[model samples]
Target: MREARPLPQYLVQRYHGWRATAFVENRVWYRRLADDGQHPRAMVIACCDSRVHVTSIFGADTGEFFIHRNIANLVPPYAPDGEQHGTSAAVEYAVNTLKVAHIVVVGHTNCGGVQGCHAMCSGHAPELEEKSSFVGRWMDILRPGYERVTPLPPEQQIRELERQAVLISLENLMTFPFVKMAVESGNLSLHGVLHDIAEGMLEQYDHQAGGFAPIV
Candidate 1:
């Protein structure tokens, strides 16, 4: 096994800076959170892309949101085969234990995972098509999404595929028994959103309209 090393100097300096400022200023709140435990009202499943900051976008406090990040913000269909499933585990915990009122899947523009899925589905990414490739397998969850946008132009397909990631995850979330129960009983709500990094725009899926609309 590879030995772990200490944090890089830059990260250490940033940690120290945060500890001195944010941590010190909110010491009491932090302590309260430690003692009381987190009671986040929403669980946000967002892309692991560094630019998509879920907390910053919502202006959320430290314990205000329970967040999970994965490539392309994809959530696979409900599979209970006794295998290791990180995204499913997080969803189960959030719904059953945390009892969060909201579950939001946040997809973003220019997602590498989405682009990879497009390439793989188009037979251009042989490396990702290999069985040994984890990302390739993970992206297989979005294959249906790719099929939905096949008639579009290549560039448009990529853009639509990004939104489809959010829609697919939202649909997959309903496959989870607990999530479905909560939504049926009006205890939990599901939301899908797309964030355009460069344009600084956010569009939310509209169930009635059957497409996404700006939050305005």
Candidate 2:
């Protein structure tokens, strides 16, 4: 096996500083969490964008949320084929093993993944259409979302597609039999959220209203 390179000095220093402060401030809580396995009540599926800070937005504590990050925060339709599926694996563990009470699919404004999907679908990004592109394949999950938002003007398409990403994920999550059963039996609930990075605002999809409403 090849030896791994050491972390950069700056990152090492920052980690040490954070570790000291975190342990000093919440020693007991951290210890208890280590002793007892995590029992998070919610599973947050969020985009892999650095600007989208799920824990910070919710002020969540350690062991509070079981988080899964992927391109566009997409949850593809439930596929039971004997294939390697990272997102499905996470969903299964969170829903069946962890038994989370809630699942939140969080998308954000100016998402690169969503934009890439839009570009690919619109025949603007030919490079992403290749079979060898992992990103292209991953972004395919948002293709359906892009199609739904195509009717709007080009200027308004991106934001709408971003919101659609969350909605698509929420809808796809229910395709899992366990998720459907849980929701029907009142054991689980699903939510879709869109975060605006520039405005620091959140919009939640209202199933009853059939639209995204800003969080006041």
TM-score of each: 0.98, 0.97
Off by over 4 Å in 1: none
Best by TM-score: 1
Pairs in steric clash, model 2: none
**Which pairs of residues collide in candidate 1?**
none
For each candidate, C-alpha RMSD in Å? Answer: 0.9, 1.0
Clashes of each: 0, 0
Model 1: how far residue 127 lies from native, Å: 0.8
